[model samples]
Target: MNIKITGSGSYIPNRIVANADFAQHVFLDEKGAPLTYSNEVVADKFRQITGIDERRYVESDLVTSDIAFFAAQRAIEDANIDPETLDYIIFAHNFGNVKAGAIQGDLVPSLAARVKHSLRIKNPKCVAYDILFGCPGWLEGVIQAQSYIKSGMAKRCLVIGAETLSRVVDPHDRDSMIYSDGAGASIIEGTDDEGGILAHETASYTYDEAYLLFFGNSYNKDHDEDIRYIKMYGRKIYEFALNRVPQAMKECLETSGIDIKDVTKILIHQANEKMDEAIVNRFYKLHDMVTPERVMPMSIHKLGNSSVATIPTLYDLMLKGQLDDQVLTKGDIVLFASVGAGMNINAIVYKI
Candidate 1:
């Protein structure tokens, strides 16, 4: 028996925030001092490094769960499956739903349960839960779904990755530019088909890397120090990801018995254009080859980094033929990877 992604969908918010949008904002350094350069110089430098021109944000009327439900609905419709038949719904996210103008996360009911409720799935057997694995959350949910299907705990599952980061960002921090809001979902089920998820790998470095990404006080010291928002050591995290992620991908690919040349698409987490490129290049170098053309599809230029939503969101867009020059055909081997908070890393070798 095999587990496969039978359907996929994504929710891209309507609001477009371009790089020029930050021109008048005050960007501060760690010491609470304003940057010496103008916001234009800073934004331009950021563009060159991250390849982000614009990003999406959920309107004030919506929250994370709303978009998660939106993506889930489309995925269900695409799969053409009865909601009541689902055996599980796994939601992956770091920060839960945060209301507009609010600093706290609302998780009284888990996001997965919230989505399951919103989905109107009345089957009590549909075990719903949430996983906080940073940017890899979505892929990790897929891995969990694969395990459930393989272990006979489930036959059909829905895995969703969604976030509304615009509400939680520190407007004063330059790193906030890397965040956006979006959601992506997939329907996974047991199949008799020939190709599916082949192998997966996961790693956690908690000793030295634990604090690479964390929630910290606003960069503007005047802002309440007790109030924290998503934060990271960008350079340190970049260096760490470049060194670790490729090795995990290579190990997963080898475990699948799939040659590096067979990987036609690499739907990596859309973190940063430069970091992702360096990681992919290193992966190929490990195989004694070079990175292949069009093997890597990216959405960061416009979508920015929606944390756990990146990989699944990229997959949904590609499968729908929305991504220029990218498409997935039957029997194509694909690789998915991500590294983020928790200082976590993961990769999956899959056949589509």
Candidate 2:
């Protein structure tokens, strides 16, 4: 059996957070003094470094599951499938729903369960669960759904990746600028057709690098002592992505017996604009093919890194012709890749 995405949808928060928004929230020193820097200077540096002008943030009352619900509705409508027919709801996220003004909290019933309820899905047999694979979580969920379809355990699956990174980010931390909130979803069903999810690869290198990106409270005496936030060694992650991601993508394409030149688009994790560009270029270089200027599409400038939500949301946008000069047609070969907090890397090949 083959697995194909029948429909897709995404929901980005209405709240637009420009780089200038960070100016007022800069971190303070140990003595309660503001860090010596102008917001304009920092904003310009962010643009030059990450190519991000602004990102979205959910309102105080919104949570991860809520955004996922919105995306799911759009996806199901696009697929034109009955909610009762869904056999599985696979949700992917690192931080679950956090209460307004709370730094640490999670959905007690699991995000998948919450989404199922929000959709008013009444089928008791539909298995709903969550997967935690860092940024690769959504792709991993799709992989699991494919396996279920192939084994005849399921006929249709809903895969969702959603996050509210702003809730868990340390406002004082520079990395805060790179995190955002959004959701994306895909409705995948079993098919007898030849083109779908062709081949894939996944990997983890968490032995010593598990802490490269981690969640912990700030130790600064002037900051909130009990609030949890994400922290990372930026240089280490940059080096890891530049070195590992391209090789993994190359191997995945090879496994599918697809030539680099045949690929139509490369939808990579919106981690860093420069890093994603370099990874795609490196993959094509391995095959002695010049990187096509339009081969890779990016939404990071507007969405930042919503962790698992990045790839699928970008994919949805491209499929809908919302991304400038990017579109997908029948029989087009597409590639998906992501890497993040789990010290994880993964890629998938699909035929549209």
Find the candidate with the highest lDDT and give its number.
Answer: 1
Model 1 C-alpha lDDT per residue in residues 149-181, reported as the tens digit of each score: 989889999999999988888999999999999
What are the lDDT scores of the predictions, listed in order? 0.93, 0.89
Where is the poorest 10-residue window by lDDT in model 1?
99-108
Best by TM-score: 1
Model 1 bad stretches (over 4 Å): none
Query: Residue 328 error for model 1, in Å?
Result: 1.1
Q: How well does each candidate superpose onto the true structure, as a TM-score?
A: 0.99, 0.96
**1-352 per-residue lDDT for model 2 (tens digits):** 6799999999989999988888777675434456688767777877888889899999988889999999999999999999999999999999888877875677689999999999999999988999988999999999999989989999999999999988887666676899899999999998787799999999999887788998866635556776667888888998988899999999999999998889999999998888788888888878888898788888999888899999999999988999888888889999999999879999999999
Cα distance off (Å), candidate 1, residue 192: 1.0
- The alpha-carbon root-mean-square deviation between model 1 and the true structure, to one decimal in Å, is 0.8
Candidate 1: lDDT of 75? Answer: 96
What TM value does model 2 have? Answer: 0.96
